[model samples]
Target: MFKKLDFFLFGWIINWMYPEYYRPKYGYQRYYILFFHYLIPQKLFRLNPKVRWPVHFTSKVLAAENIKKGILCDPGDNNNNYIQANNGIIFGSNIELGPGVSIISSNHKGNNLREHTKGKPITIGNNVWIGANSTVLPEVSIGNNVIIGANSLVSKNIPSNSVAVGNPCRVIKPKEDYSEDLSVIIFNKKIVEKFDVFLNSNV
Candidate 1:
């Protein structure tokens, strides 16, 4: 009961203090709402049907018509006004999207920046792990079990079971099943040699 009051008070104070800032910027408002929604206990706000938290929309979040469940969005992930056709975004169970991730589903037609034309939709496969601050452009299909490294800008399609990284990301390694644990799969001789002290401790 007291916690609910605190949540409302905090939101009210933010609204009161920054009316101009919060009114126009939907992104900021969404962040504020989501912060309180998840941070506070679900019991208090669950009763209020009117308090629908906003999903931080970026230049990439086409229409919200096709968004699915089991998506863990970091505070920095922004989906623009990308159209969600037939529920384009199909995330698998246990997908973690890090901060500053941008999943763009549509683009403009003309070269002129002022025009309002639409482009293609983005399709992300199941069990895909997108790292922090990644940008996924339109008309691209990322295959299942793909791991995209942090800060990568994906402009094309990525094959299944691959590791892609860097600016305008390129495939670093093909999909392969290893019998060893995750630590062995990711770290090679270089890492093991350099961090022998820490690795030995874990072992």
Candidate 2:
């Protein structure tokens, strides 16, 4: 009974504080855990969060208030993510950022090294998967259904339905069609099959 009451209370508070646009695709229990692990340290102790979404404990998100995210999409959910949304960053649905990913929207001024220039806002489209240790510089717009490979530097705009990689990050090949079905992930493995299939059940 107490467990049920606790879940219900936290669920209500979450729904009140965050609207649908600010929430992840996971359930209430995951949100509660993230609150204790990530949000508490970020908001109360460190005073670093401006959005109420679930961020990993090791991630560093700056100027989160300047970011606008879509439903079921969060950029800094992965480990060791450095998201500097000082100018602005808009994210579409189902964004997957790998470890050590840096999405910086502000650039240092050339005249004054200490000052930052307000560049264009970085906009990421739906179903995009940026690989590990990738750095997306300012004023870049990535289209939908794109995959950026590991250790790439994205300084130019990438169109939809393309697979790009490298230091300067160019479109190497076209991407295939993608499914929007729900998927499940397991620990120490990269599993992204359908959620029902993982549960041995029917959709």
lDDT of 1 by residue, 48-141 (tens): 1211223333323344445543322221233322223332554433245656677765555568766435554566764567887788776788
Question: Taking the tens digit of each residue's C-alpha lDDT, what string does model 2 give over 91-156?
Answer: 876678999999999998999999899778999987789999999999999998899999999999
Q: What does the lDDT come to for candidate 2? A: 0.74
Every model's Cα RMSD, please? 13.8, 7.3
lDDT of each: 0.50, 0.74
Model 2 residue 189 distance off true place after TM-score fit, in angstroms: 28
Strongest candidate by lDDT? 2
Instruction: Give the per-residue Cα lDDT of candidate 1 at 2.
Output: 47
Per model, how many backbone clashes are there? 14, 0
